[model samples]
Target: MLKDINLNAMNYFEAVARLGGISKAAEELGVSPSAVSQQIRQFEQQFGVRLFKRDKRKLTLTLDGERLFQTTTQAFRMMRDVRSAIQRQRENRHFNLRVSPSFAVRWLSPRLKEFLDLAPNWAVRIDAAPDFSDFETEVVDLDLRYGEGGWTGLHEEAVVHDLVLPMCSPGYLEELRALSDDPIGQLRQARLIDSVKTHYRWDFWLARHGVMGERMVYPLRFDRSSMALQLAADGAGVVLESSTLALDQLESGALVPLSTAFEAIRFPAYWLVCPSRHTSRRIVRIFSDWMREAGRVHDARAAELITGLGCRIREQSGRQLPGEEYVGE
Candidate 1:
C-alpha cells in the first residue's frame, strides 16, 4: 500500500514540470529557488523515482516521471474544477433574464413582483438592454425581445402578439368619442404622439386604413414605445402603439383605445429567448411556462377592457388570441 502524498509538494512538482525549470517555477510560485528544489526532491523521494533528469539548466522528465506527471496533473486539475463547481453552487441562486427597455417597463416590471412572490427561493436578475443580448457569449439565462420568429441557434418562444391601436387618456378619449361621426378625421387632426424607434410606425398603420397623418408638419417624438404609451396615458397626446404595453392603463381607465382599427403586427412579436441548452433546466422551464400563461391572461384582460366605437368586446365564448407555446419544450 502506498502512503498518502503531500499535495503542496505535488503542486510544486507540477509547476516545475510546466515551467521546464526549477528557478522559473520558484519565481512563478513566489518562493525561493532552494525551497522549490527541496520540495521537488521530497516529492520525487516519496514516489521512489528519479522524476526528472537535469542537464545544464534543462530538466527533462523520465518515463516514470511522465506517467506520474500525467496522473497527478489531471488529478490537480480535477481538484480545481471541483472547487470551482462547489463555489458556483454556493452563490449561484440568481439567474439572469435580459429584456428590452420597453418590455421591461411596460410589461415585465409589473409582472416581476408575481414571479418574485411565487419563487421566493429562486432569484431573478433582470438585465434591461437597449440592444439584443449575445446569447452565444453573454451569461444571459433568458432574453425577451421583439422579433420575427426563426431565431437561429437559440431557443425562442412567442409570448405576446398584440394589436397596435391609437391610445389616449380619458378626456382625450372622450373628445374622440364625441367625434364618433368622423373618428378618423378627429384622429388625423390630433397631435400624433409617435414612438420614433419602433419599426411599425404610425405611417404604416395609417396607410393601412387609407388615411395618413400626412398633414402634421411635426408629431411629438418619443424615443421608446413605453415612453410614448406613458405620455399618452398622461393625456399628453394620441400614441399609436401596442395594446399589450398599455394594458394596465386601459384596464384602469387611465388610457383608452381611440380606434377599433386593431392591426395585429405579424413580425416583431414578443419572443422569450435563451440558449437551446438551457430549456432543460427546471427553473427555466418553470419560468417559460409561467410567462406564456401570464401573457395569455394579460391579453384576455386587455381584450375585456377594449371599449371602442361605442362597443365593448364580449368574446363569443372562450375565444383567445392565436397562442405560441414555448418553442424550447
Candidate 2:
C-alpha cells in the first residue's frame, strides 16, 4: 500500500481539499480541471476510500481525507522550508571565483580586498588556473576569463578592453637607444621576451606596424604573462604584454614603453562569464557590478599613463595580420 501511494495524486488531493473546488486547485497548479479530477479519482481508487464528499458546487474532505491532508500539508511545508534554507545558504555563504594566474596576481589580487570589505559576511574562494571552469562539475559562481567571448550556453560580457604594447625597463630602453637611433634597429638588436601563450605576441605587434622582413629573436620565453612582465621589469628584455596586467609595473616606473612609433593595440582581454541562472543571484550580481566599475577605473588610469608616455591607443583588427615571416628564434 505504501509502495502504491502516488505523491502526485496526494498533491492534487491536498490542493482540492484546501481550495474547496477542482477548478481552483487546477488553476493554482496550472492544469485543467479535468486533470485534477482524474488524479483525485485515481487517488481514491488506489486507497479504496472516498477522499472527498461532493455537494452541488463544493468539495469537503472525508475523515480519512482530512487525516491524509494534514500529513501531506506537513510534508510539503517541510520540503519547501528545506529548499528555502538551501537557497539562502548558497546565496549568503560564499562566492567561488575562477581566473587565470596572471590575472589573479596582476589584476584581481590587489582589488579583492575592496570586495571583501563590501561583503564581510561572505567568504570568497579563488582558483587561478589557465583552463576554463566547467560550471557543471565545479562550484564556480563566477569566471573572469581572458578571451574574445562567445562561450556556448553561458552569458559572457566584456569586462576589460585591454591594450597590448611593447614595454621594458627604463634602463633597457636607454641601452636599446644607445645601440641604434632607429626604432626598428633597436628592436632587431635587442632581446625580446616572448610571452609564449599570449594572443597578441611580439610578432602581431610588429606585423601591425609593418615592421616586416627583419628577423626578430626572442631569447627569453615564458608561458605566463606575469613572469614575462617580471623579466621585462628587471631590464632583461622588452615584452609585448597587456596594459591591464602590466598596469602596476608601468605606474611604479619599473616598466616604460619601448617605442612610440605605434599606438597601443586594443583587444577585449577579460570577460565576466557565468550561466543565466547564477546571474540572478544577489551575491553574484553585486560582485560582477563591482568588477565592471573597477575595470572602468583601471582603464581611466591606464589612459592617463599612456598619454603621459606620449603615446596613443588604437583598435586592432580581430583577424590576424599577415607577417609571420619576420618572427623567428
Candidate 3:
C-alpha cells in the first residue's frame, strides 16, 4: 500500500497540513494553490478518507489526518537526519554547537578556545540564540543547554549544578550597607536586578533564606543573564544569578556575594544535549568528554568561590518556584 502511494502528492499533503492553508503551503513549495489542493484531494481519494475539514476558511485536521501528519513529520525528520549524516561524512571535522546567548557569552565562549586548541584541525561553529535547537532539522551536532533536563528524543548529560545567589558590585554592596545595618532590611531598599528568563529569581532566593513579606524593588529587567550580571557589576543593582555564569565577575572582584549568612540555591543548571544518533560519533564523543572535564573544573572553582564568600549550598528540588519559567538561561 505504501509503495502504491504517490510520494509527491503525499509531500504536498504534508505541507498543506503543516502550514494549515493551501495558499501558504503553495507559496512555500513554489507551486500554485490549485496544485496543492489537487494533490491533497488526490491523496485523500487514494486513502479513501477525508484528511482535512474546513471551517470559516480555516483548515484543521481530521482524526486520520492527525495520525498521518505525525507519521509524515517523523518521516521528514528522519530524511533530514540522513541528509545531515551524509554531509557530516563528507566533512566530519565540522562541529556545530548551539547554546543560549547568555551561556555563550558568559560561560562557554570564554572556555571554547580550550576545545579548539585540543582539536586544532576541526571547524567549529557556535550558534547562540534564545530558542532551543530543533535537532531533527537543525545542523547542530550538540547543544550546551542551561535548563532542567528531560527533553524527549535527545540525550541530556548533566554538566554542572550551579549555586544561585544575590551578587552585586563592591561599591553597590557598600551603598547597600550604608542604607541599613539590617541585612534583610537593606535588601528591601536596594535596587533589584532580574534575569527575566532564568528559572531562579530573587524572590525564591530571598524566601529560601527566610526573608519574606518585604517589598523588593526591581528597577531593571533583562532577558539575558550576561546583561544582568554586567548591570550588577556596574553598580546598578543586586542580581540573583548562577555562579557559573558570573565566574569572571566574581573572580575579578567586579561582583561580590551579598551575604554569606544566606545559603545559595543549587540546581542542575547546565546540560550537554544531543540526538542519540550523533552521540556515538567520534567528534561528538570527543567534545562531550572535553565538556564534562571542563564542567568538573568549573564546578570546583564555583564551589570554592561560594565557599570563599562563606555561603552555604542548599539543593533546590524539581518543584516549580515563584517567577520560574522553563526557559533556556
TM-score of each: 0.63, 0.70, 0.69
- Candidate 3 RMSD computed on C-alpha atoms after optimal superposition onto the true structure: 17.6
Off by over 4 Å in 1: 1-88, 174-180, 261-268, 307-329
How much lDDT does candidate 3 score? Answer: 0.85
- Model 3 CA deviation exceeding 4 Å by range: 1-92, 210-214, 322-325
Model 3 residue 257 lDDT? 89
Provide the overall lDDT of each model, using Cα atoms, as 2-decimal numbers: 0.73, 0.84, 0.85
* TM-score of predicted structure 2: 0.70
lDDT of 2 by residue, 227-328 (tens): 999999999998988888998888889999888876887877788899999999888988999989998898888878887887888875453434321110
Model 1 residue 10 lDDT score: 87
What is the C-alpha lDDT profile of model 3 across 46-79, one tens digit per residue? 9999999988778999999999999997898799
Residue 259 of model 3, lDDT score: 81
Q: Write the per-residue lDDT of candidate 1 for residues 80-186, one digit (tens) a residue.
A: 89999988875677778887787788788878878777667776888877667787788878888765556678888988765556778888877766766476776
